[model samples]
Target: MTPPQVVVVMGVSGTGKTTVGRLLADELAVAYAEADSFHPPANIAKMSAGTPLDDADREPWLDAIAAWARERVEHAGAATSSPYGVRGVRGVVSCSALKRAYRDRLRGAGPGVFFLHLDGPPELITERLGGRQGHFMPRTLLDSQYADLQPLQADEAGVVLSVAEDPESIVRKAVTALERAAGADNGSGQATG
Candidate 1:
């Protein structure tokens, strides 16, 4: 059987990472994690005050999320499942992993970790942020997030889904893409493993 998959729902702020990630987790029948929960109190306070976190401030937070991912994968290691019906011990996380280095840190968590990048126009995201309430990440830092965003590269196990579609459709697309990626990786001569 294929190993369990850890899907990282990644995007800049206001791209519906949490909403879509929760629905995706439900669809896949996997445990869900919110990356914001891993943020240190100081980081949260800084963001709440409209301060963007430097890489120095984010390393620990990213490492915490990586540790959580590794723990979940380890706990699910012995679980078995067939190719049909219920899948492997899947897990989903929503994170604003806006740079390649950050994504590399997440990839280090374990095997079968893939990314689902929710991407859309800046205007659309800005509009969504304006309407959102009670989030530490404010609209003021949107530009920095965009500047930091580095799309999944050729070697990455991931797919980019447009936010123009509804959440259900996006999740569906993600599942299909993940299945294809797993298949490709399992086939002969596939470089991804």
Candidate 2:
């Protein structure tokens, strides 16, 4: 039996991580978790007030998501062992894992964990941020987000997709990348054990 694939859709604010993540989850018939929903209210307040979140503000949230990912993988493993159980389930999470360390923490959860980096030009991201209604992240902080972004390394187990593309295209690209990665891993007979 094969293990489930977990994908972390990552980018700075207004890069459409949540929207694309949800759509990707739907297309893959998997579970979708929004990283923002796990954030503490204080962190949201800080960002809403045009204040950037320091490492201290992000530590707890990142830890929570990592734990959640681990738990999901464990649950899927258990279910797959049952005689009448469903096939393994995939997990798609939307997060602003701006730093390499954050992405590493997520990868530590399990093997076959992929990161999908959604990127776009600053001008486009700023426009999207401005157009968003009632979002906690202020447009004033878009610059801060751009400043904090760290591009994923070539060796990372992930794909980079352009947010400037249509949302449907972005979703298609992400899902296809994940499927191909899963196929490769399965063919190689690697286990997440």
Best by lDDT: 1
Worst 10 residues of 2 by lDDT: 78-87
Which ranges of candidate 1 are over 4 A from the true structure? Answer: 1-4, 77-86, 186-193
- Per-residue lDDT of model 2, residues 22-140, tens digit only: 88777766778999999999999898889999988988899899888887787764322112122344688999999988888887778757788898889899888888998888888
Against the true structure, candidate 2 reaches a TM-score of 0.86
**How do the residues 74-139 of candidate 1 rate in per-residue lDDT, one tens digit apiece?**
887544332333355468899999999998998789876778889999999999999999888989
**Local distance difference test scores for all models:** 0.81, 0.76
For candidate 1, what's the RMSD?
3.6
* Cα shift from native, residue 59, model 2 (Å): 0.7
Candidate 2: where are CA atoms >4 Å away? Answer: 1-4, 77-89, 185-193
